[model samples]
Target: LDWSFRTTTRAAQKLPENVEEILTEAALREAHLIRKYDIPAALRVNTDQTQTVYQQGTNTTWNKKGDRQVPAVGIDEKRAFTLVPSISASGELLPFQAIYHGATPASCPDRKSPFYTEAEQLGFRLEPSKSDTYWSTMAMMKSLVDDVIAPYFECKKNELGIEDPDNQYSIWKIDCWSVHKSKEFLSWMRTTHPKILVIFVPGNCT
Candidate 1:
């Protein structure tokens, strides 16, 4: 077996008390929600976001002697994409969404491309965010709730013979971020998705 040592970033090295509280609350909330709603594991869902970069870094590479830089074939190393995925406690998966930086991809065919519509058919949504280093914003979160979360909640409720609107509930977990703290986002969650409760993980924990 081979092993190597690596250094983690400041965020990875730190584990604050707030993180503990968030974990505790998450567990308690899940238990309470299940008991109160009589929810099956299949109906309880959680979601998180992750980013994928197009570049790979290597410490060792074969090259001509004293070559200034080795030739590498890859897409823009600095470019990245964020993916949001949801899965139920029972392992049921919801359609995933991807966020890109620009209004349209450089590879897009035309100004009136049906790429987005095509993606929708394949159970994925590809969209652009406001910033180049795109993090999920209030608008994006709202769209996520409306187009993905709400629909999934309804589908699960129907499948489990729980149609009493009032009785159907969904538990969605997300990290604590500024975009998620918007008044509009909170109000939308409360009113538009009354049955779907969004839980925030502790700040700096995720």
Candidate 2:
């Protein structure tokens, strides 16, 4: 059978040549440092965010013949959020942080959402973006550190009996998102979470 297959190129291809080199060296250095410092797997964590739609899409659904629609009622095509999750090398999963669209949630209407109560019960935090396009920003990065990462770090430190602020360091591997590498954010992270060793993967290389 003669047929054609469509292929889509990824944005990662446009990344600079230095990106791979940087990523390779960073990973090697991180591994070396971890071994040299005897850092436990429990403290080595990697975090990433994935876009999630209010409604999930599927293919090959069971429907009446010639029917184009699958009847997804109340599905907001425009509504979306990012699910940021962290997992340590030792398999410890941290509570997810969700970035939702809007400056502030409308309590009356939003609180009634079916996903609202369950999201809260699962410890998913909803943070708003000024433009409703929830790209990570310096302020958001700071908020994540302050509201989520910092407290988690403290608790893990205490639980692991990892005292001595110097050796209490944890490896935080995050993608090299622009905001994550911003000067203001870096400065703030360094000063605030001195025990956290932040490592950035190649830009868009994830």
Best by lDDT: 2
* Minimal lDDT window, size 10, model 1: 103-112
Model 1, 1-206: lDDT tens digits are 59677444335557786777777887897788778877778667777888866574444556899889877655236667778998888888888877777665552224366666666675776667765566677767887888888888787777878758566777777776677667778887898878777777666665
How many residue pairs collide in each prediction? 0, 0
lDDT value for model 2: 0.73
User: Which digits, one per residue and each the tens of the lDDT, describe model 2 over residues 1-206?
Assistant: 89776444334356666787877888899998798766788878888978877776543345798886776544436567777888889898877777776677641227678888887776666777655476666766777777777777777777888756455777888987777878888888888888788987666554
State, as a TM-score between 0 and 1, how close model 2 is to the true structure. 0.74
Candidate 1 matches the true fold with a TM-score of 0.77
Local accuracy by lDDT, each model:
0.73, 0.73
